[model samples]
Target chain A: MQAFDIEVTLGRTRVLHGVDFTAKPGQVTAIVGPNGSGKTTLLRATTGEIPFTGRVLLNGEDVARQKPWQLAAIRGVQPQSTTIAFPFTVVEIVRLGLTAGLSAANTDLPVRALEKVDLTGFENRMYQDLSGGEQQRVQLARVLTQIWQPMVDGTPRWLILDEPVASLDIGHQFTVMDLTRDFATRGGGVVAVMHDLNLTAMFADRVVLMQDGRIAAQGTPSEVLTDATLTQTYGCPIPVNTTPPVGMPFLLPQARMTREPC
Target chain B: MSLAVDAPSVHAPPMDRRVQARRLTVALSLLLAVTSVFSLAWGASGTSLWAAMADLAAGRELSRLDRIVLFDIRLPRLCLGILVGASLAASGAVMQGLFRNPLADPGLIGVSAGAGLAAITAIVLGAMLPPAIRELTGNYLVPISAFFGGWGSTLVLYRVATRHGQTSVATMLLAGIALGALAGALSGILVYMADDSQLRDLTFWGMGSLAGATWAKVMAATPIILAALAVTPFLARGLNGLALGEAAAGHIGISVQLIKNTSILAVAAATGAAVAVSGGIGFIGIVVPHLLRLATGPDHHSLLPNAALLGATLLLAADMIARVIIAPAELPIGIVTAVLGAPVFLWILLKRRGALGL
Candidate 1:
C-alpha cells in the first residue's frame, strides 16, 4: 500500500499536509503521534473513507479508480468504534464480513476469527451486552474475517486499522498485536495508528512518527525512538531506555516536580 | 504465544438463527394463507366459502350471488389487503434500516400524511386539469401524485434528521410530527373545498377501509407495490451492513449511497401506492416490523419477508374484526389496527426506554 502527497481538510482546518506513506507486504507499519497530529486522518484518507487530495495505490491499483467491492477484496478496515443500530449476535456481526471481498467463500472464517480474538464462545451473545474491550475485539474478529487469507491470488491484502488496541486490556492488546504480526508474517500488509509507543516498538517493523501533520521521523524503532526526538515531538521530557540484551528502545515520562524537587 | 497455544476448542458450530428464521418464513406463509381464506369466507355478505367449496365437491355450479360475492367483492379486498399490508410493513423495515432507528415509519414520520394530502388534492381538483392531461392520467392521477408527495417528504425528512452521516432519533421524530401536522392542515383545507359528493368520499377515505377496494384499485397498486417489494431483497444486505452505521458499512464494500437512495425510493413507492389505495392506515408499518424483530432477529434477510407475511396476515385479521365487531355497518380497518397496535407500540417504547435515550 502507498499514498503520495496526501492532504486532508476537515472544515477549515487542514489536518494532513502533503504526507507520503508506504507499507510493504510482510511488514507491520505503525503510525504513532500525539493527539491532533493527524495519524487517524492519514489512515482514513488512505482507506477512502473520507475525501482527500492525493493518490492511494493498493496492490498496484489506484484506489480512486477501483470500485468499493474491488477495494474491499484487497483490504479490510476496522474503525475506531462502531455503534450497531439493532440487536445483533456476535456471530451475526462477524458473519457480516463474509458477504464482502475475497473471503465470501470462506464460511469458516468467522469462527476462526472469533477464536483468534479469544471470543470463540461469544457467538451466541448479544453484541450490545459485551464490554468495551470485548466489543473492540469482536470488531477485530469481524475485520479479520473479511481478510481471512493474508494473500489472495498471490496478491497481498491489507488490514488498515484505526487504533485497533486502544480500548483493549493489556492481555487482549497483545492478542490483537500478535494477530496483526501473524498476518504480516504471512505476507499481508498491516498498517495501524497506534497510541502506545512501547507496544509499537515491540511489534512494529517500521515506525512513522508524526508531529503537526508532517512525518517528523520514519525508521525502525531504535532509529526513530531516541530521547531527543521523543521529547521534541511530544513536547515533554521523555527519557528513553534500551533493554540490555536486545537493545530494544522504551520510554517512561517522569513528572517535572519529581525530577527536580521543589 | 502461550494464549495462542491454549486457544478455545474450535469444534463448536458458530451460532446463528438462519435455520430458525427459514422455518419461521414457512410458518408465516401458512398463517397468511389461512388468514386469506378466513378473510374471503367471513364477511357481511351471506355467501360462504365452505358452501361454495362443498358445491364444487358435489359437482354443482355455483349460484350468481356466491360468484359475485366471492369472486368480485371479497377477492379484490383480499388482494388489496395483501398488497397494501406487505407494502407498509416492508417499507417500515427499510426505512428503519435506512434511518438506523426502529421508530422510523412512513405513517409515524409523515410520509403517509404527505401522500394522503396529495391524494386528497387529486380527488378534489382533478377535474380542473386540461383535457389532454386528464385523459392521459385517468385512473393513475391520484396514485402518481401521492408517490411524488411521499418521495418529497421522505427526502426532506432524511436531510433534516441526518448530519455528517449521523442520524438523530430525537430530531427525526420531532421533524416527523411537524411535517405530519403541516400536511394535515393542508389536507383539511382541501377537504373543506371538496363538494358534497367529494366530502363523503374524503371522510371514509380519511378513516381508511377496504370497502373501496376494486379490481381497478388492486391493479393500479399491484405493479408499483410489487416493484417496490422486488427492490427490497437486493437492499437486505445493504441494510444489514448499515446497522453498523454508514462509514463502517461503506468500509465493508456496500455502496452506501446506492443503498440509501434505493431505500428512499422503494419506501416512497410502496408507501405512496398503499396510501393512495387505502387512505391512511396507521400502526401497521411500525407495529409489524417491530413485532417481527422481536420474534426473529433483526437480520433484514428474514425480517423483511416475514414482515410482509405477518403484515398481510395481521391486516386481514384486523379487517375481519372491523367487519364483525360492528356487524353489517362495519367500522374502518384503520381504527381496528390502531386499537390493537398502539398498546404494543407503547409497551415496546417502555421496554426500550433506556436504549432509546428517551
Candidate 2:
C-alpha cells in the first residue's frame, strides 16, 4: 500500500504537509516521531478514517474511491484510543470485527482472534473491567478478527496500528511487537506508529522518522537511527547506540543537570 | 523479553450469544403475551376473562354492553398501549446506541415535546383555520400536526448538532434540551388561550391516557411504529459497530453517517407517531431500554426486541394500574409509568455513578 503526496488540513491548520509513505508486503514499516508530528494524522489518512488531498492506494486501488466494506475486507486498523460506554463482554467486542468485515457468519474467528491476543478465557469478562493493556489487546484481537489471514488470494492485507504498544507493559509490548513481526513475516503489511525507538529498531524492517508533518528520514533502521537525526528530530540530546550481538540501534537520553537541588 | 510462554489454546468453543438472545426474546414475548391477556380482561367495567373467552368459544354474539366495552374500548386501548410502548422503548434504545450514551432517550432529542406542542397548537388554535382547511384535516389534524412538529424539531436539532460530517453528542443533547424547552414554553402559552373544553382535552392529552384509543388511531400509528421496529434488525449490526466509538465504527466498515441519519429518522417517526397518539407518556423510553441493557448486556440485536416486549408489558401493566388503581375515575397512564419508572431511573444513576463518570 502507498500514500502519495498526502496533505491533510484540520480546520485552518494543515496537520500533514504533502507526506509520502509506503508499506510493502512482508515488511513492518514503523513511523516514529515526537508528539504532534502528525504520525496519527498520516495513519488516519492512510486508513481513510480522515480525508486527505492526495491518494492512498490499497492493492493499487484508490482508497478514497473504495467503499467502506471493500476497504474492511483488505485492511484492519487499531485506532489510538477507543472509548466504549456500554458494558460489552470481550467476545461481544471482538465480534464487532466480524460484523464490520461482513464476515459475521464466521462465528469462530472472534474466539480465535482473542486467543491469538492471549485472551483465551476472557470471552465473558466485561470490557470495562479489563486493564488498559488488556483492552488494547482486545482491540488488536478485533482487528485481527477482521483481517484474519495475512495473505488472501495472493494479495497482502494490511494492519495500520497507531502506537499499538503505548499502554502495554514490557511483556505485553514485546508480545504485541512480536505479533506484528509474525504478521509481516507471513506476508502482511504493517504500518505502525511507534514512540519507542528501540522497539522500532528491533522489530521494524524499515523506519520513517516524522517531524512536523513531514518525513524527515526513511531508510533501514541503522541508516535512520543516527544520533544526529534522532537529536535533530526529537530536539534533545538523544545518543544512539547499537547492541553488539544483533546490531539493533538504541537511544540514550542525557538528563539535564539542575543547579539547585532539593 | 524471550518468547517463553506456552502456546495459547485455539480450540475453545465460542459461546453462542445468539442462542442466549433467542431465549431472552422468547421469554419476553411470553411475558408480554400474558400481560396483554391480563390487560384485556382487567378493565373499568367488571368483565371476567372466563366469560369473554367462553362467549367467544361458543360462537355466540357478545351482549351489547360486553361487545361495546371489549371491542370498542379495552382491546383498542391495549393495542395502542402495546404499540406506543414498543415504539417509545425501541426508539429510546436506538437513540442510546446512536449517542453511545445509555442515558439518551427519545424525549431528550425534543421529539416528544415537539409533538406535544404541535398537538396543543392544533387543539387550541386549530379552530381558527379557514373552514375549508378545517374540513379537510378533519379528525386527523392534531396527529398530523404533531408528526410534523416532531420531524421539524428533530431536523433542526440534528442540523445544529452535526457539522462537517460529525455529530457532537454534547451539542445534540444541549440543543435538544433548548429546543424542548422552547417548544414547552410555546405550548404553555397556547394553554393560556385554551377554553374550558379545549383545556380539558389538553389536560388529558398532556398527561397521556389510553382511554381515547380507537381502531382508527391504532391503524394510523401502526404503520409508522412497525416500520421503525422493522428497521431495527438492520440497524443492529451498525449499532453494535457503534459500541466502539464513531471513528472506529467508521473504520470497521460502518457508514457512520448513514447509520446516524437512519437512527434519527426512525426515532423521530416512531416517537412522533407515539406522542401524537398517546400524549407525553414518559419513563418507558428511558427506563425500559436501560433495564433491558442491565439484563442483556446492551447487544442491540437482543436489546431492541427485548426492549420492545418489556416496554409493551410494562406499559400495559402501568395502564392497568392507571385504570384499576383509581377504578372508574382513571389515573393517567403517564403518571403510573413515572411513579414506577422514576425510582428505577434513580437507582440506575446511583448504581452507575462511577461508570457514568459523574
Candidate 3:
C-alpha cells in the first residue's frame, strides 16, 4: 500500500502537508510522532476515512475509485476510540465485523479473535462495563475478526491502527504487539501510529518519525532513533541506547539539569 | 506476555438469537390478536361478543345494528390503531439508532409538532377555501398537508445538524427542541383565530383519538405507513454498522451518508402518516423501543421488527383501555398512553441516570 503527496485541510487549518508513505507486505511499519503531528490524519486519509488531495493506491487500484465494500474485503481499521451509546455485549460488538460488509465465511471468527486478545470469557459481558484496557482489546478483537486471515488470493490484507495500545496495560501491550508481529510474519501488512518509542523499537521493521506535519526521518530503528533526531524533533534531550541481546535502539530521556557542560 | 495455560469455558452458547427473535414476534402477534378481539367485543354500542361469534360460526346473518357497529365502526378503528402504533414505534427505534441515542423520539425532534401545526391549520382555515378546492381534497386534505409539514421540519433539522460531511447529535437535539417550540407557538396563534366548533375539534384532535377512524383515512395512510415499514429491514444492517460510529461504519463498507439519509426519510414518512391519522399520540414512540432494547440487545435486525409488533400491541391495548375506562363516553387514547408510558420512561431514566449524563 502507498500514499503519494497527501495534503489535507480541515476547515481553515492545513492539517497535513504534502506527505508520502508506504507500507510493505510482511512487515510492521511504525509511525511515531508528537501529538497533532499529522500521524492519525495520514492514516485516516490512507484508509479512506477522510478525503485528501493525493492518491492512495491499494494493490494497484486507486482507493478513491473503489467502492467501500470492495475496500472492506482487504483491509480493517481500528480507530482511536469508538463511542457506543446503546448497551452492546462484547460478542455482539465483535459480530458486527461479519455482517458489516465483508463476505467472509468464518462465522466463528469473533470468538477466536476474542481468545487471541485474551478476552475469551468476556463475550457475554456488557462492553460499557469493561475497563478502558478491556474495551481497547475488544476493539482489536473486532478488527481482527474483520480481517481474520492474514492473506487472501496471494495478496496480503492490511491492518491500519491508530494508537492501538494507548490504553492497554504493559502485559496487554506486549500481547497486542505480539499479535501484530505475528500477522506481519504471516505475510500481512501492519501500519500503526504508536506513542511508545520503546515498543516501536521492539516490533517495527521500519520507522517513520514525524514533526510538524512532515516526515523528519524514515529508516530502520538504528537510523531513525538517533539522539540528535529525537532531541530535535521532540524539543527535549533524549539519549539513544541499545539493548544487549537484540541490539535494538531505545530512547532514554536525560534531565537537562543533570547534564555536564559540553 | 506469556499466555495463560487454562481458560474456563463460558457456559454453552445462550439461546440462538434468531430463535429468540422469532419467539418474540410470535408472542407479540398473539397479544395483538387478543386485544383486537377485546376491542371489537366491548364498545359503547354494547355488542355481545359471545352472541356475535356464535352467530357468525352458525352462518347466520347479523342484525343491521351489529353490522353497522362492528363491521363499519370497530374494525376500521382496530386497523388504524395497529397501523399508527406500528409506524410510531418503528420510527422511534430507527431514530434512536440513527442518532445513536436512546432519548431521541419523533416528538422531541419536532416531526409531531410540525405535523400537528399543519393539521390544525387545515382544520381551522381549511373551511375558508373555495368550494372547488374543498371538493377536490375532501377528507384527505389534512393528512396530505400533515405529511408535508412533518417532512419539511425534518429536512430543516437535518440540514441544521449536518455541516460539511458530519452530523452532530447535540446540535440535532437542541435544534429539534427549538423547531418544535416554534411550531407550537404558530399552532397556538391558529387556535386563537378558530371559532367555537373549530376550537372544539382542535382540542379533541390535540389530545388524540381513534374515534374518528374511517376506512378512507385508513386507506389513505396504509400506503405511506406500509412503505416506510417495508424499507426498515433494509436499513437494519446499515444501522447496525452505524452503531460503530460514522467513520468506522464507513470502513466496514456502509455508505454512511446513504444510511443517514434513508433513515431520516423513512422516519419522517412513518411518523408523518401516523400523526396525520391520529393527532399527537405520545409514549409509544419513545417507550416501546426502550422496553425492547432492554429485552433484546441493540441489533437492529431483531430490534426493528420487534419494535413494530410491540408498538402495535401496546397502542391497541391502550386504545382498548380508553374505550372501556369511561364505558359509554370514550377517553382520549393519548391520555391513557401518557399515564402508562410516563412511568416507564421515568424508570428508565432513573436506572440509567449515571449513564445518561443528565
Best by lDDT: 1
* lDDT of candidate 1 over B155-205, digit per residue (tens): 999999998788998999999999999999999999989999989778866
Best by TM-score: 1
Worst 10 residues of 1 chain B by lDDT: B6-15
Write down the TM-score for model 3: 0.91
Query: Clashing pairs in model 2?
Result: none
Instruction: Report the C-alpha lDDT of model 1 over A1-262, residue by residue, as the tens digit.
Output: 8899999999999989999988999999999999999999999899887899999999898999987778777788999988788888999999999888678888889988998999878898899899988998999999999888899779999998899999987667778888898899999999999999888988899999999999999999999999999999999988777444566663332212231211
Q: CA lDDT of each candidate?
A: 0.89, 0.85, 0.85
lDDT of 3 by residue, B1-358 (tens): 1334343335546444556777888898898888878878878876777788899999999888888888889999989999999999999999888877787788767888888888888888998889999899877778777877887887888788766444566787799899989989999999999999988778866778888888988987898899999999999988888888888888887888889888988888888888888888887988998988788777899889889999988988899899889888899999998888889878977887777565
Among residues 3 or more apart in sequence or in different chains, the pairs in candidate 1 whose N, CA or C atoms overlap within 3 Å are none
> TM-scores of the models, in the given order?
0.93, 0.91, 0.91
Q: Give DockQ for candidates 1 onward, in order.
A: 0.49, 0.46, 0.58
TM, chain A, every candidate: 0.91, 0.90, 0.91
| Off by more than 4 A, model 2 | A242-262, B1-17, B125-141, B155-174, B195-197
